[model samples]
Target: MKKTARIAAVGVIATLALTACGSREDDGDKKGSSSNSDSTSSSAPTDASSPTEAAEQYPDFKACMVSDSGGFDDKSFNQTSHDGLVNAVDKYGMQTAEVESNDPSQFKDNIQAMVDQGCNSITTVGFLLADDTLASAKKHKDIDYSIVDFAYFDDKGNNTAPANLKGLTFNTAQPSFLAGYLAAAKTKSGVVGTFGGLNIPTVTIFMDGFVQGVDYYNEENGTDVQVLGWDRDKKDGSFTNDFESTTKGQNVAEELITQGADIIFPVAGPAGLGGLQAAKDNGAWGIWVDTDGCVSAAEYCDILLTSVMKGMDVAVEQGIADAAGGTFSNEPYSGTLDNGGVALAPYGPNADIDSDLSAKIDDLKQQIIDGTITVETP
Candidate 1:
């Protein structure tokens, strides 16, 4: 079942506040004590086994989570990861703790706090925390670590994972390709666009797939549907370089709209809200990333066409369960279309998703999963 429990972050001055003071909520203050874990109820997990089953395999476990700058409330991947952590807590009745980082600078401190609290497994959300997570895992090999939207690439460029670390990543390009195609087909202006929080691999990967999808749509229909904000071959575009500013998102969205793009996808967490505001102002459509935009950024539901979903919540929860169950592997958990790790969100009741185009997208998704289609990323 698709897991769902939404929260998020937004704005610029708030960014400054986060950097100065992190939001630390001790959910596990009385972990071993009887508490309600019944709040978790959502879609079926991609895996056959649930957290309850996984917990049954372990003797004792304590799971803790560290969020990126957006905090657990960013209403994107961070929120999804938080949900997973809570699910494991409720499903397994395990001890749990959580730390929310307001800025990148606090990643190490938040993680260290969790470790000090005696957490055997730590799940760090977001690609930004990769280096810190890797360093922590290496220093404390006994503790299991899982990171979302990131896989380690050592200095020597070896294809190896640490003994106690699980890097949870997704082949988002495959499903993003589908989203791009949908945008291309649905756009009234014959142009669509996408931008990112930073020029990092995690953000650009989505842009890459989006451009490729648009290219595929053009090829299939023999129509000229232009994409802005990214050049797949050149691998370049407008980047806010920060995940905290809606103003920047608004600026980026306006720029793309000015370039004739009627559909815009902003891959910048809370900062993407700026783009949504711009979309509403300009009377354009948007494609949200990470979660169901209709829910996370519900204020702009009328403008959201769909979302490119990366199931970080399930991946994180599963990794913790595996570690607790003594079945943890250094092998990274890769989210893919075939594994239900990633996919495109439904065009909400407000958006227009026609029957023919919808069917085509469905076929394209299966084709990508079946290996008939391959989406490459840099």
Candidate 2:
């Protein structure tokens, strides 16, 4: 994912670019741009997508990425996936490119663009593309395709059910356990909170591991720290339905703080920024998601107790390596804390957490990784 600074930079670029475009648009309007609009709008849809014949006709040897609707500068999932593509380019000298989807309808168009550009292997970076990923794979059967954070299956054995496709997923709960335990240990208010961006499996999987960690801690250490935001026991915790609403995130965190929760983990994307701000203002601590918030968002970095680190880079690296070796498998590969795919971000102010508690959490981490302890995801 992009660092917060980079996202901020992108915002500036978008603004400057928009201003320049506005000026040009104004001048064009005076020059009778009605015809230009008519031609552009009329031709846009047909030209938006490359034909299957064109994709089949192109030579394929490069790697490409079709980001989720969030785009490459979202500073979260989309950005992290882009980092993986960048790594592939640097290490393999592989030609690489990326396209952002503004909505679900653009999924196929984005994929087709890369395919027509002769990319042999392409990565789709979100679960929202589940249907489109499979459909495109069938249409372009000869291409090697990989989808991150999603899986798809079709009843037909024709082009859609190809063996050349690989789906990348991870056991996010392992690192989430560490986040929950850290929140539990660092809370001065004796209560903690967590919320998700959406109710999807990818997001709730984190909650599952977090609840297990909190429950395990209370059970083993006799700490009656009440989790305030989401009910880990029920497996249905606080969720904002969308990831872009900062006000909702802030409100949720505020309520949790009112209930004595001094630490909050918000698994929402940019919306989580609100939770962090709330934590800071309300004298609470917070946990970040996916990437390292401490480094990603340096302004609020210090307030981040820690982050649930998911090794998207490692997973992406493995996918590219597999494609190169011609050994990519459709079998879902899961990355765990032990497998080096996920874990807890380094402690900041909570670095000096209770030695005994820290050791216990470490032991639990190892147990979960080694199959001795099971961390259930809701």
The best candidate in terms of TM-score = 1
lDDT of 1 by residue, 255-304 (tens): 99999999898989888888888888999998888876655666776677
Tens digit of per-residue lDDT, candidate 2, span 47-164: 1122122222222346677777655555456656656665554455555555666556777777777777676788888777877888788888777788888655456523333676
TM-score of each: 0.83, 0.78
Query: How many residue-pair clashes does candidate 2 contain?
Result: 2
Native-referenced Cα lDDT, model 1:
0.74
What local lDDT score does residue 37 receive in model 1, on the 0 to 100 scale?
A: 23
Which ranges of candidate 1 are over 4 A from the true structure? 1-60, 153-158
Q: Which has the greatest lDDT?
A: 1
lDDT of each: 0.74, 0.64
